[model samples]
Target chain A: MIEAHQISVKIGAQFLLQGVSLKILPGEVVAVIGPNGAGKSTLLKVLSGEWVPSDGEVWMAGRPLRTWSILERARRRAVLPQDSTLAFPFTALEVVLMGRTPHCKDLERACDYEIARTALIAVGALHLEARLYPTLSGGERQRVQLARVLAQIGDTFSIHPCYLLLDEPIARLDLIHQYSTLQIVRDFARAGVGVLLILHDLNLVAQYADRIALLKSGRLIAEGSPWDVLTPEVIQSAFAMSVVVIPHPYLGCPLVIPSPGPDLVPNSVDLIGRCKEKK
Target chain B: MGTPAYVLTVKSLPRRRRSISVLTILVILLMAIVLASVGIGVVRISPGQIFAILVKQVGISLSRPFEEQQEVVLVAIRLPRGILGILVGAGLAVSGAAMQALFRNPLADPGLIGVSSGAALAAVSIIVLGTKLFGGLFHALGFFTLPVIAFIGGLGTTLAVYKLSHFEGRIQVTTTLLAGIAINTLAGAGIGLLTYMTTDVQLRSITFWNLGSLGGTTWTTVGVVAPFILAAIIFILQLSRPFNVLLLGEAEAEHLGVPVEPFKRRVVILVAMMVGAAVSMTGMIGFVGLIVPHLLRLMIGPDHRYLLPGSALLGPCLLLTADLIARTLIAPAELPLGIVTAFVGAPFFLWLLLQDRRRGKFL
Candidate 1:
């Protein structure tokens, strides 16, 4: 499990993240959803050991995060940033194989290559293996980067329960790729890897996320199962926009639809009044 | 989960046969260049006589006899010079490849660290003020004084750049480049001032040194430079994997288990040492490091595992070929080695840039 306990990040006088505590346990998918400037990426950075919090502490597997050597932490955790800017002529396979650096003793083994190929296959990027990374489309590059992070964890070769932290992994992906990528994360979680994702689309988050942590103004407004956190009152408070939450006919989850805008939607004022009363 | 099983389907990757073939070809080319370079000097020796003389040095008596003068010239004059060319070439080329990796910029070269300008500044200072500056000590050091002083200047400038760019715990790439720019300009001004102070004979030596040469190559100079260059090349060759990972940016490399800061620090120091040692001996040989690695990357791709070694081998070949032309094209009055390289390299590099632009793959 990866736990961020009362972590707050401060840059000068501003607090990017304030007293945000969260946990990603084994065999679970925790999605962090927020409006723009809600400090979702900063929280992810703190959790992934990229930034040290100004207050409180982070723990992974019952030990303080700082105690883990870089190698040991790398073996147990993998982070996929929002975007990776690799401007080299490396083939996709070569890019994927770089993830095996921490695992290999000296040179990468045949098994590591197999792991890399399997990762590409898992992310539906197998066909891109021979293509140069720089030549790939943006969506294709995202998938290849996803494959790289997956290859880094290599769950089949690791004995320890690992954590995967993704900051907007599906931002550039199409609808089909977005679902497929989330599904892949869901599968990894089901296979006992803890997955923490920062996502924008709430409807997809409603369907795939076991739990959702909603943030507003660098503060977590709500954290619970999708049903509890996706309520009209909670969504209205967090986004400052009226959203009608209704149960999906096909899926067993709440579906969120935003009421256009204050001037455009005639009923949005009424919905906001009702949400205020509930709040 | 207990070891999530994978049903392997993809075939294993092909072995590194291409890299092996490339290295093999380079080794063969280097051998031919070395032989041709050694045989083409003022006293021309046939390939057969050269082979006989070389074998005879190892206690083998060949049926073909060679002249004593030929053996004397070959062993004393040409052999050490050829070896020096190989060492300096390999050193500069490998250093270039490593610097490009560290900077993650294709245009980065050994000169970016202020080595060339600093060495030039030091060499010019010595030429203009050696006797006055050091009195009897400069004369006592004799042939060793200039190269040693130049090496210290190069190393000192590199360290200053490193110190200036290093902030808190991280090495800033932009700051390092800026620092290098600042140091190079300062060194250039120093060189200019010193050049102004020189007399007629002093000015001639300064000009010749600035143009670069292998004219004074001797066994002693080769022996002094051999260990530093060899150590640096071998060290860089072992870092191909780390270098490849580094191309993915610093944070990504760290996430992949590379200690990025220390790794970068080590590479910078070693490259400085490598380039410093070579520039001290040959003054300033250009283009080998910048062009060789870029050309090899185009042929074999940017896998440093192959690129580094390929550069190490091909660097010497180009340098030896250039040195041969430098001495021969102008006859008894030698053309400076640096001029020949620039005359060939500038056009070729521009053509490469045009090709990259046409392919829409400018680096």
Candidate 2:
């Protein structure tokens, strides 16, 4: 289990995360959802140990986060940032193979290559193996990066639990890719790897995540199963927008339909009419 | 899926084989250059005689007789000079590749990062004012004073540039390039000031050192430089995996289990040690680092496992070839090795920049 106890991350005069607490258990997919500037990404960074909380503790596998060596942590957890930058023209396969860095013995073992290729296949990026990473499209690059992180935490062979922390993993992906990506994450969780994802799409979160943690102004406003947290009132309080939560026609999960506020509705229509008048 | 797996395994095998062949070819080219460098100097020695001399030195007498004078020239002058050229060149190139990896920018070079200039400044200061300023320290260090001071200066500038361009754990690519320019300019001014303060003989040595020459190499100088460069190369070659991961960005490298900060610190120091030792012995030889690694990457791809060792092999071939041209171009009048490298390297760097611009990518 990965647990954050009363974590507060302060940068200069502002608090990015203030006294927020959360936990992720093995074999569960937890989605962190919030509007812009809600500290969703900050929370992910803190949990991944990329940034230390100004106040509070993060415990991973019953050990204090700071106490774990980077290699040990890397073997048990993998992080995928929102966007990756690689100026060098490394082939996509090479990039994915880097995920095997923590588990690499002396030279890269042949099985490591097998694991990396399996990861690329899992992300449906095996065809892009020979293409240079810099030449890949935004969505393709994200997939390759995802594959890299997956390759880092190998299969379920480990007796120790592993975790995957992702920040907006499906942002650049198209609808089909978004669904497939979420499905992969869900399957990974089903295989007993804990997954913590920061997602903006509430409906996808509803369908895929076992639970949702809604954040607003660095505080966890709601935390429960999707059915419990995806209520109109909770979402309205977090996003400050009117939303109607209806059952998915097929999937039976919450389908949130956001309605624009009263003032903006007429203003948008007026702007369209004004543009016609100008024409 | 099964077929694809088999094909993928088959596809990777040739690349590994090709990399090994590339290294093999570089090794052969290096040997040819070593022989050409040692034999083709002012008093030409034939390859066979050179071979016999080497055999004799190792206590294996060859059937062919060679003159003692020929042996003297081969063993005393050309041999040490050849060894120095290879060491300095390989050191500069490997460090250049390492720097590029460290900065995660293709254009990063020892010369661009102010390491060479910083070493030049320290060496110049020692030459012009060492006896007067720190006479006691100079006497104690004796032969090592210049290289040691130069190493400190190189290490100091590297740390400064590294620290300045880093924000939190991220490297600011533009800021790093800009800081390098600033330090290079400052070091240049310091070298210039020291140049003004020099006596006539000191002035000549400083000019020669600044321009870079291997004409002064002896067994003692080779002894001084070899340990540092060899140690640095050995250490850096082992870091191929970490350096490859580092190209993904610092945060990504850390996520992959590299202790990014400490790894970066160690790399900076090793690069400094390399540039410092090389500069101390042979002055500022530019572009061997930049050109060799960049060219090799174009051929072998940017896998540092191949790239680092490839640079080590190719760097010597380039520097030794350049040294040959420098010494033989004017025949004893001698051009500076730095000038030879810059003549080729500067235009190559400009072309690289233009290429990047054409592709619309700067960082």
Candidate 3:
């Protein structure tokens, strides 16, 4: 489990994250949802130990985050940044193999190669192993990155429950890929790994995330299950827009639909009829 | 997760095998070039005589006695100069590769970034002002003073450029390039001013230094610079793994258990040391660093594990070849080594750029 206790980050008199406390338990998916400049990425960085917290402390597996060596922390957690740009043309297999850096002394070991291949297979990108990374599409790149992170924490030598901290993993993916990616994360969570993701889509979060932490301007506004966090009042207050929260007809999860603004027409049927009458 | 329908294609395995073979070929080619370089000079030594001399020097008595003039030419003049060429070439190329990886750009070279010029300026200053400034102490220090001073200047300029380009924990590439340009210009101006103050003899030496030559290499100079280059190469080779990780970017590298700041510091220091040592000894040989690693990368991909060692081997080979051409192209009149390298390197670099542009891979 990963825990952040009253974490606050300040950069040149700007508060990037303020008094944010959260926990990611094994076998659970926690989604952080917020508006622009809500410090979602900053919070992920702090949690992943990429950025040190100015005020509070973070603990991973009962030890202070700072106490663990980088390699040890890396073995226990993997971070997926929003966008990872590569200047060199490395193959997909090579990119995945980079994740196994901290695990082995010799990079050329056959076991490491096997693990990397397994990771690529797991992400359904086995065919892309020989393909150059730059040639891959955006969605394919995202999957490849996912495979890399999976390989990072999937060391066969260690049996620790790893935590994955992802920043908008599905931000650029299409509909099917979005669901499949979340399903992959869910499968990892089900296998007792904690997954924390920063998400923009409310319905996706409602569908996959076991709990949602809603933030506005670097402060947590609400934290609970989707039903408890996705109320109309909470949505309106956090997002500065009115949204209707209803139950999904089949999945029994919350479905969020945005209500039109005061000046905008609400019904598409009425607009079409008005156009017909004018003709 | 579903099982992948496609079998795990031995994609990386073939590349690995090919890379190993390529490295072997490169090493063999470097050895051939070294032997060829040792044989061809103003006084041409036969390949058999060169071999006989080499074996005899190593305490192996050959059956046939070698001629005294051939022995002197091979052992005294050409050998030390050839070894120095190899050291300078390898050092510059390895440093160039490290700098390119550090900056995450292929175009970054020690010379382009003012490091070589910085060393040259310091060496020139010592040559021109050593007698006036330190008097007896400079003479007492003897041959060690130039390299020491040049190393300090090179390391100082590199650190300054690094500090200027780095803000917070991130290296800004544009800032680095701009800082490199500014430092290069400033160093060039300093060198020009030093040139203005020198006497006729000093001026001629300064011109030779600026053009870069291997004419003045001695065994003593070779012995002194070898250890620095060796240490730098070993240090850089060990860093190949971290350098590979760093290609993922600073933050990502840190997350992957790399101590990014310390790694960057070590890389910068080592690169400065290697480049400094080379520049102090050989004046300022350009483009060997810029060209070798790049060509190797295009051949063997960007895996630093292979790239670093590949550069080390190929660096010496290219330099030895260039030095051979410089010595032999005009027969009795030897061309400046740096001019030959630039003549070959500049057009190749332009070709690389044009190729990248045509492929729409412009940075």
Best by lDDT: 2
TM-score of each: 0.90, 0.96, 0.94
* Displacement of the residue B95 alpha carbon in candidate 1, Å: 1.0
How does residue B26 of candidate 1 score in lDDT? 95
Clashing pairs in 1: none
Better of 1 and 3 by lDDT: 3
Q: What would the per-residue lDDT of candidate 1 be over residues B59-174, giving only the tens digit for each residue?
A: 99899878999999999999999999999999989988998888776766767667777877887787788778866757687766765677678777877887886775455667
Give the DockQ (C-alpha) for candidate 3.
0.52
Model 3 lDDT at residue B76: 86
**Predicted structure 2: clash tally:** 0
Q: Kindly list the per-residue Cα lDDT of model 2 for residues A185-273, writing each as its tens digit.
A: 98888878899999999989999999999999899999999999999889878877788999999999999898867763457777898
Query: Which candidate would rank higher by TM-score, 1 or 2?
Result: 2
* Model 1: CAPRI class: acceptable
B1-363, model 3: which lDDT tens digit per residue? 234465544444666777788899998998889889988876777777888888998898777667888899888888999899889988999999999899888878898788898889888988889889856756776777777788888998898888998897778777887898899899889989999998999998898878888887889999889988999999899888889888888888887888888889899889888988898888888888889889988888888988998899899999999999998999888899989998998898788779778868754
| TM-score, candidate 2, first chain | 0.94
Question: Which regions of candidate 3 fall more than 4 Å away from where they truly are?
Answer: A156-158, A262-279, B1-12, B135-142, B359-362
Among incorrect, acceptable, medium and high, the docking class of model 3 is: medium
Cα lDDT tens digits, model 2, B65-161, are 7889999999999999999998998999999999999999999999998899898888888888888897997888988888898899899899999
Which scores better on DockQ, 1 or 2? 2
- Between candidates 2 and 3, which one is better according to TM-score? 2
Which candidate number would show the highest TM-score if scored against the true structure? 2
Error of 2 at A207 (Å): 0.7
The 10-residue segment with the lowest total lDDT in model 3 chain A: A152-161
